[model samples]
Target chain A: MSASSRRGVDVGALVEQARDGSPRAVARLVSMVEDASPALREVAATLAPHTGHAYVVGLTGSPGVGKSTSTNALVGAVRARGLRVGVLAVDPSSPFSGGALLGDRVRMQEHATDAGVFIRSMASRGHLGGLSWGTPQAIRVLDGAGCDVILVETVGVGQAEIEIASLADTTIVLLAPGMGDGIQAAKAGILEIADVFVVNKADRDGAQSTVRDLQGMLGLGGRYADDAHWRPPIVKTVAARNEGVDDVLAAIDAHRAWLEKTGGLRSRRRERAAREVEAIAVAALRARIGDLRGGVALDSLADQILDGKLDPYAAADALLAETSD
Target chain B: MSASSRRGVDVGALVEQARDGSPRAVARLVSMVEDASPALREVAATLAPHTGHAYVVGLTGSPGVGKSTSTNALVGAVRARGLRVGVLAVDPSSPFSGGALLGDRVRMQEHATDAGVFIRSMASRGHLGGLSWGTPQAIRVLDGAGCDVILVETVGVGQAEIEIASLADTTIVLLAPGMGDGIQAAKAGILEIADVFVVNKADRDGAQSTVRDLQGMLGLGGRYADDAHWRPPIVKTVAARNEGVDDVLAAIDAHRAWLEKTGGLRSRRRERAAREVEAIAVAALRARIGDLRGGVALDSLADQILDGKLDPYAAADALLAETSD
Candidate 1:
């Protein structure tokens, strides 16, 4: 039987269409990844050869820091350079939460008509392996679709933000003048991940101070250990007015160059792939353990722990043995 | 040899001392949990029989919503009722972040000298199974220490907060006036998890409107579809002044009573124990996967996936087989 016939989804055809620049096919592939479909293995195998082509840029900050506006502007700038761009806005809000962040995507309506630009918003909640698994799978879909650049925008919550940083080739940490994001950026461990820092809403008061604050903190953090190391640059932007966006683009390009020059890009992608593999493996193990709930294994183990006859670690050891078997 | 001689930690002595209300022993046991020490299995086994005695009350909300204040007030209320209380302030902030929340624990210091009260702050970052594994282990420590009530206070970040809700017998969601927390609550999926809601800073403007907004939303959500259902009661409090804290305590008591009357308490505990067991197992499985990174199996699989020669799911299958072996 043909590979397509073996699976519910015609993975081979869909992947071929996605590579031929069909947005519908790309969207369907991404949806399948998001849903964690049974045919995901087939989809991934089909798309594997076409990925590693897209440059992923991650933008993250607290809510209302103009992530959508900045992403929209970046898409325009990247497209001006005659490159296909994909925008993946990872909404940190719960799925049940009203789509406030998703609603913000209306600003990207200008790019809706451009065939070169694909915009999609993912609710970063309730995924099988959490956001880490679903996000990279979606990125692979876009990359397979021949995108030159993929921009990932996420609300800067603590752990989720860190996970996104690991996925991107370049990470831009956004801040606003009056948002007290300087302190928050430090608190959220954004300084360590930011390849480029964009101080959005620079037209407002305290913009210079915010920039200075970042520079001072960066110096104190000793982020630059040597002259050979690439130091993150701070770019001021008025994204709402589409101002200073070119500078942000330049910063991104500069970082990409440093990465390519140092062979950091290859190493980073290697590390990311390792994490992706590990995450999938862990999720699969967890699912197997979950499947055992239907049997007497997990419930009985839990009962033993609950009744104080066995500790959790011992029960876990029993579970591991059973699942491994 | 005794079990204590087999491990680095004298688990039996520690558990015995903690059961005798030795604060140092309780602190040591909790520290072991937080650190995920090698002796943790022994500790859990020792503490198991002593658990399932303390009632877990989770207090969570956005930063600056007075979680610490409300927690402090509730501790006092519980103390007034002659109950031994354990306050576990689970700091959801990154450990690298300045200890801003750790500073918040200063407010809980009045109970510092009280032998009946044990307050500990845990950074909810970098634990093995995220916060799920560590928090409950710490709760077990406190429960074994003879706490009648254990309060788990966490910042209402997305996933972490939901995990905390599951750990608690009663989850109290705190919101301050003018924080627009009503919309945030629904967005964070707190409405479904909240066993009781507290509108803190009731003296502030918009307190009544906040209450009304919550009531309207709760009514619309139909949380009380049947008469037997426990509709989460809204208690207004100026936690700073200790005003209305008694009412909050009463609300908690009422929820506990309802849980017991409906046999929900036993089921919830059973479910929590199951989750605890599962989390431990998952963490153990992940650790095994992590260990494989030192071998050629994981790195080679990652290299293949990075080169686009293999898909992640296929790689994961290989990893599971290797780990199982």
Candidate 2:
């Protein structure tokens, strides 16, 4: 297809195909949404009525913590429960090559041919946060595609990964043992968002000690109000060996149950929807600003500041003055 | 001082004291400015004439990766060269306590009584990018204080830490050996910005392998047309023992020399200043929007979105209607 034609994808036909269980259509729709095409937004207006079904589980961690392996194992476990699964592995685009390596696909080879499973990788494309603006919209596409569960594996680049906490209903923070003070650092921003902590690579020597240290750091609970129905649980797992995957699945089920009973799940979904809309609005504003010769003016102001002809404050004032109120 | 009184500091007196080589004045100025008060910005305007002498170096890494130790050792190294040093360590506010722990003070105790070195710690205070909006103004305070070099130590929370890269002349990304997979993950966002890479904890078993991996991943010896005059070098260090710090200083000096020769440093500094101004302007707009009850309308629109009474697109359109030209 021509690039313009691809960009101007027929949203209704794609949605129909996705609803009728065409994986190619689902992938195309995901691409369209992730690109934040205006056409895709129109499609989302139609698909929004069909969403709110899939139980989204976000998987995130410091890179090399085996999140993909854990996600693969979780997919298997969820499949064993007779539910369809959709996986969205968010990775950074190579600055040299705009294409994502789709590293998660290699690890998730087992699900490649499984009709009940769908896997897609989203690239950052140097977006402000690690997630693209269209991520929530893409998630809705997966939701409308009849997937019982959707797993979002985040780019484990720290604070940006925390945005996933706001996006997912259940967020699992994966960690490996013996990372030499990494656990303490991880606790700085990501710890609070974790609905479940999976100490992956449990076969490693310091796995038990890592768990003990984390439990000690967490300090006997009640940090958050107890009224939420479920407390975050730390589960030990050897993802490569497929051990403890069942426990992780059980923990997810328990959290989902609590979310349903306490109405927290609905509230979280509502917040996510709100955030998605705000993000889209902000992105549109940025793009509009860019097209209004803002980039050229910004560069010239930057040069003037460098030349000492203009101080930053005055330059900012001038830029703001140019913006129509 | 009462917190508000502390906020209402005398910038002129502080600038005069700083010019006369008073560390206390510099410290108070940084403290006043780091709070991001309008008063601080006013102070900055008065001090702007006396600023632009100090070379700013931003040091960042994941928390517990020994950024403080490295920064302390760096201060020592810079002082040995007879240049006065100023350190600003940015720490995230404790969610539970709402007070900063000021951990850099504990780590850099050797310089506590030094008349030549001024150290201050800043709290992130929920700033989105791990930097308060007033940080550049604080740097101006230190600059006007006659410090030869100012080192900014970031909160080390990954993505938020990237903000430091924009503000500093030379940015160093610290990693430790045996953080294998974590290194790959960090490479996804941060490794590209490293003007210098220090492999801390080089005493570990996989230190050499880690260095080799980094060298391979970075593809050294490949010449690019846009290459900065000084190529970033990977240095090994054991921060606790203060090993290889001199080499880091030498690398920084070399980078500085190259920056000056190529006029890259001046341009980079100007770019940073321009960016700071733009950020402030954006923040002002956002604050104004909030003050006008724009957020209330947005929130109500969000509620309508959750109730399915209004679609996100329409809600966004409605929210921007007043602002749209």
Highest TM-score model number: 1
The second chain of candidate 2 has a TM-score of 0.80
Best by DockQ: 1
| Inter-residue clash pairs, candidate 1 | none
Q: Give candidate 1's whole-model lDDT.
A: 0.85
Query: Candidate 1's interface RMSD, please?
Result: 2.5
The best candidate by lDDT is 1
Assess candidate 2 and give its lDDT.
Answer: 0.73
TM-score of 1: 0.69
TM-scores, all candidates, are: 0.69, 0.58
Candidate 2 i-RMS? 4.4
